[model samples]
Target: MPDNQNPNYEIKTIVEIFKQENLTIPEYQRPYKWTVKNTNQLIDDILLHQEKSKYRLGTMVVHNNNGELEIVDGQQRFITILLIAKVLSDSNFLDKDISYFLTHLKFSNTISHKNIARNYQAVISRASDIVNEKFAKFFSERCEMVQIILKSESEAFQFFDSQNARGKDLEPHDLLKAFHLREMNDSDSSEKIAVVSQWENIKSEDLAELFALYLYPIRQWSKRQSARYFSKSDIDIFKGINLKKSPAYPYAQILRMLESFTQHYKNSPDRLFDNQEVNFPFQLSQTMIDGRHFFDMVSYYQNSKNKLFNRLKENEQTNRIISTLDNQEYKYRTGDKYVRRLFDSAVFCYWDKFGLIEIEKAVKVIFLWAYQIRLTQQSVFIESIDNHARKDLMLFNKIYEATHPKEITQLLVNFKIESKAKNSESVINLAKEFQGIKNEK
Candidate 1:
């Protein structure tokens, strides 16, 4: 591509190319990193100049290179204009007089005015593929794309990359984006995390917003920059706590934070800083955890559970199931196979970790097995079993896994129950007996 020292170009609205292929941001060219603040400023500039130029001058700086005007520094601004135009179009704000002026406002309109005007519709037709809808319609009624000459696509791409990277100070998420895009080929498991993968699918602007909401809290928590960096280990610790137990669901944490932020600035939508927006109420101090840490904790918990469930499901290794007793908590009823596996695992964890006395463990196990089988089997004779045995069994089952039948024999041997066959029946048979008991009572 020929590099023009002072590339002469004409301004075109982005809406003019609405149907054009999104120029695959060349691998060398970084993704769009402009902040909302920067975009808002560009809008200010465009509005100020457009008002001064009577919307006829169309104060856009387009460089002439090859097929289209290569918008090096103004792509985001052009995009914003298109968005504004869309809003205006949806509102039916554009008049016929304004449209007519936009149709003939291109460089070709002044160059090969007559010949270009003849094929103006065709050129605008192609140009509309890349142009924004609002600006394209605005220009179509006035000047046409046939009025503009060809420009080099490569030169435009190069200019856009060089100028944009130099102008903006990228945020943490921006750097993370660049890192991910550059090292997407990495083999690290952390890199393969679902949270990171999901981040890759969204726009850089959205990613930055998420990062800011979460990272800003870390900044507050730390005395050093290194401490401000949120890591997988920190998130892992938070997730462990979450799995242990909580009054609220994991998602509630982030939603709670957003609600807090929104409430803090409800009166002043324009303010960026919380202090500038309003006096932040210090109520419910417990809810004031850092947004990033809280979100990461929840994300890690959800992602880990997802990973474990998927892994187990794929391997058909769901040996220990602890299904919900009711539908309210998104629980499913437990099947017999699931119950047995879960009981075995719970005994393992409790016996190995908590070191319950052997006699106590046996007493607990037998009682639990009897009660569970009765509950599931609907046994009628459960009332005939000693009340103490029933109570101990229920308590033990709650504290550990009640699914494993092996625990029953272990309990019988430890308690040294002389009459093993006295109360002994298959859980299914006991269930039948329990049902009869229920009818009798």
Candidate 2:
């Protein structure tokens, strides 16, 4: 248990937080990513517990960076409650004092700004009739948060991780946001805000889905390994470059060089206002930071021209292969549930590196290899086949980087499985089809 004597925290009610204290969302914090569903659920929860004398919302870990209280955890909940307050104030449901306090509340410009506004309005519209002065009074007075204020930034994050592990875990992306944001602590406010906006603009669900379905799998495949479930630790894979720790920390060396040059150039500098060292405040480009770079990569993957389905719409050969796979008559089930994830990984890798130039050949080879494995190996459990296919595809991808389809086909054929003869036959047919495509090209 943390030391109680010097916890440096106090329990604050909604009214107290708004009336007495000034709160700021740290630049490291992700923008408001809560959806309307989350907003409605919170409202419902508050309403459900309104009968009680006091309701505890939960814990919020904050850091007292000098005098400014930077929220480290419970950002989602904090923003949601602020939205509730906004609704109450707008509807004239809150007391004059509380409403005035809410009026002074400020929010940083985050990517989820529009969504937050939309959801706030929705809450107001939904509770227009039900929320009155009495309801607002109860909320401000009764709803409480155990605000734990820590002295150091590291302590705040440790507290956050410990609490999240015990309680309802935040999504992996949320953790990544926090981690990356911490790295940007010294960055200019505008840089932090811009990165937060880009990070939040990508829907939370889409970010999670992309990592789980495509990015994670492709990464694993490149290493000649089967993709496993994504976890918080996997966030490191997406973190492309660590700006702070890198030797080429773009500005630090240059700043030092500039300072030295300036000192040498001036023998006796004019005694200007209060001999304070001149500080250079500059924002690094997004590409310099890991968090921003990761988001940029995700954006690229999502909108890249060489994307499989996007290419399918324009390329007849690509469409034909996909069509054949989708056709029910061929027993090539492309149903949502039955879609081979391995093929998705393959397409992502091929497109990410090579683009549309050789996309047809790549897609056709991947689909046929995947299709044949799916067709012939029935007796073996589906899970085991999936595991094997991932490994085979992983190996094929690595070898394919240096060689062509023939070598990739040979690598795929090497995987030992049930019904070897049938698998071999399928591979032969695929090779023939692949050769015909190459011949035509």
Candidate 3:
């Protein structure tokens, strides 16, 4: 294995990569995962950029094992290009490395074989027009990729991890994990491994929901910003001050202060016999602390959000309020669902702030605030729900600034319940139960 300090990597046409050596698929590589949609996307991308002198397709990493270039990444794109060459037919003129790929390529996974066959048909239908030599040569000679050739498979994998982590297919949470992990450079290696392993053990969809449904909206709403969309661009919200590189700003100092106290409390000698473990008090709406705290905060809040429902269930009044909203006729409408999300988000942050203190009233206040938008508007949209989130008193803003439960739970917004709105008159009358306000109609 050569020193990975400087791996051999450079720009190469698809032809150069293929012709260099026998492109072998490593055992670790997942079966070719490209689908018809992915293939069509590649074709459209190729067509869109064919006129350029050189279009950098993307990156590929290969482990050069005894001259056999084992593909550590870009297997999907590599195979798709070969399939394109095969469709353009008599393409021996363009490059023969891809021919070796087509003739010898085998997949043990049935899904791979199925998708390969499906994408083959797609290419035939899409690439038949490129039967002429010009387009074929352009694909073979003009399109380039950054081909990273590492000496060992481990080096190849390391290179692949560094490059492919930011790929288009990743969700925002995945990006956040990568970022925070990088920030944990000074942390204990074992703790870093444990956090990442624990994170990966979770279902991907749940992590996505944690960020998009709860964390993102709550963060934005607390700042009095619209959060209808949570995308890669908004990940900076979770990435707070990197303490290693941070100045002594009071906000950053507060997180540092809490970190010191929590660590001392947990590591204090009394913990062993008493089992009085103290976790860093993580407020969902608080300014984020960087690195391990970010990961710990994520794991904590995820479990906290799940446990909150059970906590709510423990209280009869909160249960009754929840039951009331759940039984509403408009419960399943898109607007109604958004309204419920609004309620749940507020409940999540409220409980985070006050530990279910007067949670029944807290939930009722949130319910009235959220569901009122649904009852008052004939058609509630993402915008309406988001706007209503910060409308007037701004419920999240109230929760953020308040030191007491009543500051949020007791706060009320006055808007006439529109009886003409789509929600059954029954949902409108729930205000009477929730807040003692009757529909003006």
Q: On a 0 to 1 TM-score scale, where does candidate 2 land against the true structure?
A: 0.70
On the 0 to 100 scale, the lDDT of residue 182 in model 1 is 28
Kindly list the per-residue Cα lDDT of model 3 for residues 299-385, writing each as its tens digit.
888888889987787788788767766775667778778878888888887887888678887877787788777777788788987
Please list the residue runs of candidate 2 whose C-alpha ends up more than 4 Å from where it truly belongs after superposition: 1-7, 33-51, 83-137, 165-169, 239-241, 247-289, 305-308, 328-339, 379-382, 389-441
lDDT of 1 by residue, 251-310 (tens): 556645655675667656556455464323221112323322333333432333335434
Judging by lDDT, tell me the better candidate of 1 and 3: 3
User: What's the C-alpha lDDT at position 201 in model 3?
Assistant: 53
Kindly give the stretch of ten consecutive residues in candidate 2 with the minimal lDDT sum. 279-288
What ranking emerges by lDDT with the best candidate at the front?
Answer: 3, 2, 1
* Candidate 2 per-residue lDDT over residues 349-441, each given as its tens digit: 655554455667667667765555554455434455356555545443463364444444343332233333332333344545664533233
Q: How high is each candidate's TM-score?
A: 0.24, 0.70, 0.66
Cα lDDT, model 3, residue 164 = 48
Error of 3 at 135 (Å): 27
- Model 1, TM vs. native: 0.24
Ordered by TM-score, highest first, the candidates read: 2, 3, 1
Q: After superposition, how far is residue 425 of candidate 3 from its true place, in Å?
A: 4.4
Per-candidate total of colliding backbone pairs = 53, 0, 0
TM-score winner between candidates 2 and 3: 2
